[model samples]
Target chain A: MIRKGMIILVLVTLMAPCVFAQRVHIDIQAQSFKKFKIAMPAYTGQSDLAASLWSSCAKALRVSGVFDVLDPRGYITTAALAEIAPGTLKDWSLIGADYVVTGAASSSAGNVSMTFQVIDLSTSRKILNAQYTTQQGSAYRAVHAFVDALLESSLGIEPLFKTKIVAIREEEGRKQLYVCWPDGTGGQTIRGGGNLVLNPAWSPDGKKIAFVSYWRNNPDLYLLDVASNKVRLISGLQGINSAPSFDQTGNHIACTLSIDGRPELYLIDLATSGRVRLTDSWATDTSPSLCPGGNDLVFCSSRAGSPQIYHMEFSSKKVRRLTFEGGYNTEPACSPKGGLIAFTHLASDRQFHIALIRTDGSSMRVLPGSGRGDESPTFSPDGRLVAFASFDGDLYVSDLMGVAPVKITEGGGFQEPSWSNVMK
Target chain B: MKIGYRGFVVVLVVSVMFLVTGCAKKAVAPPEVEVTPPVVETPKVTTEMDMAEMVDPEVEARRILDQEMAEFENRDISFEFDKFNLTPEARKILAEKASFLNANPGVNILIEGHCDERGTREYNLALGDRRANSAKDYLVFLGIRPDRISTISYGKERPLDPASNEEAWAKNRRANFVILNK
Candidate 1:
């Protein structure tokens, strides 16, 4: 009996080291601006449908700027079923892949079902495994869902793939509003056939968009229900009624109304259609951006001789100037976390550049790689990226790190790009 | 007595020549007086005949308003870079505009505030509002009624010149006047 007990204890001691060896901890925060290497094998199913899903998933991941997607030719594991099963980490690790994604898709009677898994190549552990069913035409959505899940699992960060970007696109001397995916795909014009439409602001719920249109021969504010394509007039004040921004609750809006004989900030209650004047300055005050909590707002005011960003507290009714470095800074957009304010700064070179400043006015940094005439900088929902419009009218996305500025839109006259919150 | 009779005959011949010349002068004077009456009455007759064709005040006001609109459209008040405060030159132009408004009290004007493409759209719009209001306030101070003037800020949307240079920007940062009613 004593000899048998000694043998069993020795066996358990030997297995404990192997269990510890199989656990992989990928500290994504430590990677910072470095892209993680990932290998994605082709999904198995209806050949054409699987190929389409594979391409979309790969594109979404690549455009996210967090992954260095390896070419399929470098992937030695060609079988999707084999790659996703257990004990296949050695093959992917051999090719220097930190993470591996494999999926199988099937289509029947116009419905498509896909099963996908994200594996940690170092420890041979499956980090994510899920199945999604959708109409065959909506395969792209399913792939986006999977990519978002993989992102969350691998990086421990919220996914931005499900969010949309609203911007104004001009064509043939006409300006229109459009909504597109983050990757600049699936662009559809929501409204057009007007003299000019600009400054699209998305509601916090992502169901409505408020924009300025000259349809009535006046620059009036209009709200569009994105689902029904219905338009409603929000404010048609006697004078300039423009630059509408929704608060966090989505129940109140802050905009610039000239009804008081000067461009001033006014908060409009969506339920009662009542307005409360927030600013009464003789100088111009416009472009009110509400912080995440909706209790505070940052806007551009010309009270200090030139356009500069200012902060206003709701309860205290106190107004303070936030930006003073540049003689010209305007169109301030507060981040989702309410810690940073992004604005357009007119530099000494007489060119506009996108810049960031702390909400408390402690630090200021001009984001690198900003093009001339870059204005209307809006932060992504996660605050990881900032999308802005350039002078040539193309929309470009830049990381908060100020690197890898990718032009996401083509053609000209795309301005006022506003990122939407992640949709449920 | 013989010398006196010879002198009298000379006087009689001289008097006869004087009478003939006097009658000829009298004949020319009547014709001149006849011609002067028609020349003086011609303008009076036409003035009376065309009483209905005389300028109607409404039509005259409209004509003046049209002329003012055309003139002011070309006479936009310009400002320095990133400035909404009126310069001496801008104020002078506004004073002239105020006088025009005072003269044409029946006309209502819309002051369009504009800006160069040097700033953000929303800020430019606000700056434009300041510019238009600045002009309006000066007009009010100069005795133009506030109700007679309205203001709108076009920001950097409608530029006079789309070129991206100093000259074009200077032209773009201006306040334009448009006639809404007269």
Candidate 2:
């Protein structure tokens, strides 16, 4: 992560004309500024694949919340639609673009090649360029790779491209476990789903999903191996065994169990099946989310009279209240980056909204464009975007840029969406 | 005797299914006589006289147990929204359940605590836990063995009403009883 006040200057230069025909190459520096406006025109290519890749790239840039992506309709022109050139730099800058990225895609059969360049409008010189050869219709993978590399190298941040979210889609009492990309593509229902699956939490390795199911007529925590459809019951104690969270090691889970006659937080070791009690409150303690570091857990508790988020440290067993403004704040999801915690807050309007606060319980605010009845806020693997179930029961992903949360999923009744780690 | 009766029922159902399929196939294609080969399996089924001889007291015992268990399950105790404490009416219901449980020895029950859709899924699960176990505690106090009763909270995932209205929500927040065999 970049320091809040630091600055980075990104530099890019073009390769020779012949080499640029098939592939673009240039140098790059780090970038620290926010909201750098960039104009991207349709890449020069004849295939429909090129058009699809362009739209995918444009949406990715906008969703990153790092760039003010200029509206393509504003940049549409007779010549701009046909081809991209260095001569178009003036047109992009005239539209108040501080930077411009242009590309060309050509594909036949199984192979597709994409050549792209990023230019700094102030210098009127190309600052970065690259090329990729990939399977047709998956040129977006190259774009994702580029964005991942660009963010890591330039901003010290992880990109959220091509990530998958697993959520339970329920209709007419049949709940099927659904997994899809952030853009609603490549969706497939995971096997071994039951009629009552809730609260999916991804393992750090992205290879497993821990969720609650009632296959045995009890709400027990179950771990599902993504590669194989095999499932193993992680916890089946009496009463409720829900809200499973994998610690950083993936060998332990922090969950809620009521075996002691009331709901309390418990840590179950995956290896020994041993358990450790974490909370001793008389009130119900649930929705435990392990921080990225695994030392702290943010969970919703009724210890303070109503549902509120609490932060607990394992070493000292110290507990502190996190949310005081809302009487119905719950379902806390600690970010992967370990700085912020996202949770559902019942606003004064009686609508549940997704809100974020620092780990210390400061700077609490509802996320912009958060819908009513929003619950189960899960962060992207990179901590850049948040995927949550909206009021209408569709999965929505937003970058917190004040843009309305885009519905990345179509099916209704998506509940407790758990985002997998960036696809390995 | 139970095994023989169940076997007879299975064979009877399978033969009926075969007859139905055979007739459908004949209607679809009269020339395909090979499709009606179920005639060979028809003789394997036992006559009604063999079934009449297999009847035993165990079958009547099971029927009575099932009816009594259904009544036990149908006697669901309700709670106020977001609250799990037993009320006067709920306590009266539980007192009657305690007698039934005392009379039926060797029978175990599972108490499922549920919530309405008005609350979030995870928190309601915890609430449901308290709701179900609260009933279990009272039963244990009323002289029922703790080992005879188990509890599970379905939270808001399983709803009795499945509606967004208050009446449905009221019907949903209750502790339901399920019979389990030893």
Top candidate when judged by TM-score against the true structure: 2
Per-residue alpha-carbon lDDT of candidate 1 for residues A282-329, written as tens digits (9 for 90 to 100): 788899999988789999988888888999999998999988887989
lDDT of 1 at A9: 16
Query: Which of the CAPRI classes, incorrect, acceptable, medium or high, describes model 2?
Result: medium
lDDT of 2 by residue, A1-424 (tens): 1111111111222123221121222221112334668887777887477678877777666666566678878884524343346676688889988867777877777767777777678777665566666665455666665555445433455556546778888777677677766666555666455777888888888778898888887888898877666789998876778889998889999999888889899999999999999999989899999998778899999887899999999999999999999789999999887888989888877788888888999988787555557878888877767888876688888764435677776657777788878655
- Each model's TM-score, in the order given? 0.77, 0.79
Instruction: Give the B-chain TM-score of model 1.
Output: 0.65
State the displacement of the C-alpha of residue A155, model 2, in Å, after optimal TM-score superposition: 3.9
The DockQ assigned to candidate 1 is: 0.46
Model 1 Cα shift for residue A58 (angstroms): 4.1
What is the per-residue lDDT of model 2 for residues B3-106, given as tens digits with 9 covering 90 to 100?
99999999999999999999888787545454544445456565457766677899888888788788899989999977889999999999988998998988
Q: How high a TM-score does candidate 1 get?
A: 0.77
DockQ of each: 0.46, 0.53
